[model samples]
Target: MKRAGTHRSDSERIDLTVRDYGLDGGIASAHTVRKRRIRRQTRFLAGLAILLVLTAGGIWLIKSLSGNTAPTTESSQPTTRPSATTAATVTPHPTSTPVPTPVPTTTKPQLSAEERQSLLQQAGDEVVHYLDQVTTGRIGIYFQNLVNGESWAHNDKMPFVAASSIKLGINTYLYSRVAAGEISLDEVLRYDNRAYPTGDYEAGTGTVQNLPNGTELSVRETSKLAITISDNCATNMIIRRLGGIDAINPWLNKISGIVDYRQKVSYTNYAGQSQNGRHRTCARDLGLQAVRLFSLWQENPQVYAPLIEDLSHTEFDFGIKQGLPEDLVVAHKIGTNGAYATENDLGIVFAEEPFVLCVLTEMASAERARKIQTDIAAIFYEKVASWPWP
Candidate 1:
């Protein structure tokens, strides 16, 4: 008779199934079948071993009860000693085989590359539509996902009055040099005509002017005031320390990857030199500035985190910040020139999906600029926050 539960042609049937699956698939199926066969063989051998041990014990018990261990002989020989117990000796159980651990699978679902690109495209459309509906005059925007390399821009290369946004570059250059040990924070700089090479004196949006001419502040204090209060005097102090616009502009261009970052121009400093802020920057370049600073902070968080901290506490809150949630932390610098009708904000937003965003607008009044900036920020933040980021 054939086997009670298994057919004689089980392997043959499995072979037929593998052939039906085709050459490529047959290899995978065969691998699985071999593993199953090995496991079954291991179990069968263990059971066979237990059966033999039991059978031997049963025979020994019968001999011991019948008193028939040794065969009868004509001459008596020396008898072997008996084990002291009346019961038969039994075999111990074998240790079990360990099962291999399975690899863990990711719990969260992931988006395909095409899907991610499609969604980002949709976001860009929404942003452009919003701009068409509301904004007027020259406007430029740059946004980049820090998590992924995907980016979006609208007129990002267009030049705009840098206004106070240059503070981002000035302070970043200062912090980077300080980290590299090229400059020290304790070094004292004076607020005088030296900071204003074009006979400029602090007059725009800071408190350093209130301290009077020739007021000496440490590089640390000046850096703090320049960012937090948008202090023009403090900014000039930093600019002078970095060797002024001629010295600072090249470094800014090289690191920011922009041709025109902060070109030198005549503007009023303290004591009524002139009444215009002439520094120039654009949206994309400003975004690069923030991105580079983010890299520095990543390299040595302790050394660069203070700059982020200072950016978080800046005085102006009407531009990009006006759109974000109040609870989240946003480190940014604001630049404005009511005279030139230029307003801008540069920032690193720490969102569910963090990003660098820079928005620059010239010829738009302060009120209109605020609305345009905050609204665009809201739209982008929604898009980034909704992504199923890997």
Candidate 2:
């Protein structure tokens, strides 16, 4: 008998379904055939029932599990979501890339050769304005700073009949001689009446005759009086002691860098001299002289310190020193014979930014000249206050 619940080939099944014949063909063994067919049918029905039960159990399990799970939403695509803590721990790209920027090269602007000349020409415009104001009488003026560089009015080339201001040259020369050991500052210098010379009344009657009877004074005292008070007698005495105007020439040449710095003794004394102040000076050169004096203070501190310190001792405040702040020092020398005719002040005006002024004015009246001096000084200080130095 064929085994029940076993797979049978199609040919075998068909063969089993047909009645098989024994060698003797009687009825094909009726009882044997019936029993074999019944067993095969029972095995097939049991397999079908077991297969249906298994299918139904599998569907039930799937549906029951799906009911307890999260519902599917439009936004819930099948993707792996990272934990919030894990996302927070991750580093992110910077909003902007850290690109290396090329450093900017800074180059100072260079002025063309012509541009330098033009700058000076522009400064000249202001000079011309003042020059126009003093057209009535000869006008001279200049300005500069060793720190500030050079600017001019009738510079060294344009000579003015330097009046008492010439004492500046004399004093500077004498100071140099003393520095060189040619003269002793303590050496007593005598004043012979002949050493004093007389000039126009604008130069004045002088004060030499007023010196104490046959009294001798040291070179130091006389220089002080000559420079600080502009005593004409004292100046003449020093000039003679320094070996006359000729002795001052070599130094003057070196300083002025020109041959025109001539000194002709024009007075016996400067004290009480009418101050004809008519002594002429280019506006610019006088200013430069003042600057040079200040520079000397800087260059030879030991030698010039006292002199510069003593500049505050200047007695005349009517010129450039007028109207300036009281605290600021003005080391200046002023000259004017009468009113607006000729007025000049050469010296350094110290403020935050110090500068030298050499202004010469020959105005319509001495009063006008004085007024111009005051006005110009005020204007200059105002302008300098705005300068870049401070």
Q: TM-scores across all candidates?
A: 0.66, 0.58
| Candidate whose lDDT is highest | 1
Using TM-score as the measure, the top candidate is: 1
What 10-residue stretch in candidate 2 is worst by lDDT? 96-105
For candidate 2, give the lDDT. 0.60
TM-score of 1: 0.66
In model 2, which runs have C-alpha deviations exceeding 4 angstroms?
1-135, 154-158, 195-208, 257-259, 263-281, 338-340
Q: Write the per-residue lDDT of candidate 1 for residues 1-390, one digit (tens) a residue.
A: 767877648787767786665445556866776787899999999999999999999999998978875776654754465455523553544222111112222334377656766777788899899878876667889998776657888888766678778888888888889899999889988778433665326677777777766788899898998899888878887887887877878777886644365444443322333433336677888998898888778777767777888887777777787787775567888888776777788888877666888988765467887888899888888887787745
Q: Which stretches of candidate 1 lie over 4 Å from their true place?
A: 1-109, 193-195, 198-200, 257-259, 262-278
Angstrom error at residue 378, model 1: 0.5
| lDDT by residue for model 2 (288-378), tens | 5666666666656565544554455766677666656655677677765553245667777765556677766554566666665666667
Error of 2 at 327 (Å): 1.8
